[model samples]
Target: GMAEEEARMMRIDPEKLTQIILMGYTTKEARRGLRSAQGNIDQAVEFIIENRRLREECHREEEAREEEERIQRRYGLTENGQKINITYLQQLQSMGYPRRACVEALKQSNNRLEEASEMLLTNLDTLITASRVAKRDNEDDDDQETELMEDATHIPQLIALGAEFEEARALLEIYGNRLERAVEELLQKAQDSYETMHEHNDPSLFERARTAVEKRMAKKIRLAEQSAADQQRRT
Candidate 1:
């Protein structure tokens, strides 16, 4: 009688409550469902049925999307509007073309595997030469002289200040390793960049144009004077 009364409070028949419990629901869980349904057995059953149906639908949708992705990958159809054949990729790789380079060529050749391969082969020499040139450029970047200049206290200090070692060495060379002049040159460059970024025009466009011309003339005069002084010093 007590069990039946408890089931009545849940608004379900005792047999239905027993069946729900036997279907792996705890009594506490069944009680929660009754509360959610406002003690309506029919509503609670309907809610549980809808929930299960929605969950299954979501699961099926997710499985379908995953299967589509798997099929796409197997056929080498990229999601990025490019259709690359896996067999073509393997054939290119076998012929020593880099995978990334092959992909690029394939895209450029409109995904025609034979055309992509031919393009790569036809320009192989030019490509190799270009690649070598790029590599040499990188090596040149790395080969900045690390050796300390004869009069410099630190080579890395100049490098840290964004001066290539050779550039710093040349500055030091020209100034006979005077740290002050080298540092001044670097600071001047920074100042020039700051002035360029912050430079404001006069309210009058004529005034702005005049100021620019004057600055250019003054720069030329200064350069001529410096050149003369350098030549006299050399003599």
Candidate 2:
């Protein structure tokens, strides 16, 4: 009714006004656009269409961000959904696995703690028997095993260079265990990331990134505390 009233006042047809509203124009916005276009329905609709496109784009971006945050919380992923939980590492440690071994398993299993743990428990000595018995084998299995070993070996080296355990392993696996290449690639990525942030200079983006990292860190801290308590109880 308000749209109709505004349309009547502006000498625009009721049908045109309804069309404008359906195109995501508010009554006031429709009136303004129509008035600026000298009451041309086509011109007003063009304006509404462009404005609606921009609004939809922004809405989609916000929805995507919310979904990502939700997934991070649900799956215990790190800030950018690229890392596993520290809690998983702590849990495996509480189960008597070494930190290095736990890290290796997690890398091999794509961060699935249970799968990694199982892999750690299974004996690789059976590999000789399996190789003798098997008629056909996956060509990539050996390559994958080699890659995992490279990740395991280079993780410590990467940590020595100031990268965290998971971060180091991820970079090495990504760069195919060429240590210098991985380091150079990571350095370049960091530089590019910094330059992008500098160019945008968005405080809100920074805040959101900080909040996500803090959320992951806080969860890890809680896991550490819980693990300590459990160990004390056991002792």
Candidate 3:
């Protein structure tokens, strides 16, 4: 019910998603950000709750997207738009080339089995190198994906401390391995975001939160300076 309703609300403009990705947001973040920016918020509290749910759903949606991409890369669909011929791929693979290289050759040859087989035989080295580069990129992404799992360990703690799951994970990722820092930042965001979302309806409270954030940052700077000075003296 909610899935259909949300789909109706935001179909996710592919052009917007591409532009957002080019602007340096990850594909997942771009999708989530689009959902957030396009949501029609009736109330601040409701928006906060809804945003959390949307973010959680964004994770699942992104997973599905990743699966689709893998399928396209390996198997290729039957229709147009970069679809590889599975038969061509299989035949080429039977010739002892990698599935990755075979898929690339098939796509490069427009799914003509003879041409694809010829390319695989003639340009095997280049095809293998290109696939290696792509595999390397995917490996790098796998490392970053592992980092997301590492960040997840702190979610229960944050939730127990009364912060939302998705918000806590986002803050922890932004802060990177600093549980205390992420918690403080999450609290600040919760306060500031509600005020900002509500059209500054409570400017006084927002101002106080800003003041506290400034003080915290100053304290961190002072601590860093002291540590650096101590190191300099030791040196």
Provide the lowest-lDDT 10-residue window in model 3. 140-149
Ranking the candidates on TM-score from highest down gives 3, 2, 1
Per-candidate TM equals 0.26, 0.27, 0.27
Top-lDDT structure, candidate number: 3
The candidate that wins on TM-score is 3
The residue ranges of model 3 lying beyond 4 angstroms of the native Cα positions read 1-70, 73-80, 139-235
Worst 10-residue lDDT window, candidate 1: 140-149
Q: Kindly report which residue pairs in candidate 2 clash with one another.
A: none
Clash totals in order? 0, 0, 0
Model 1, residue 141: displacement in angstroms? 44
Compared with the true structure, what per-residue lDDT tens digits does model 2 show for residues 1-235? 8898666656866777787778777997787678767678898877767777998999999997775554334333332345554667668645543444554456556778778778756732232233223313433322222225424545545555566666776787778878898888767766767767786775557888999999999999999999999999999
Candidate 3 lDDT for residue 211 = 100
What Cα-based lDDT does every candidate model obtain? 0.62, 0.63, 0.66
* lDDT of candidate 3 over 4-59, digit per residue (tens): 98886577778867776675556766666667767322232244456668988999
Ordering by lDDT: 3, 2, 1
Alpha carbon RMSD to native, model 1: 21.8
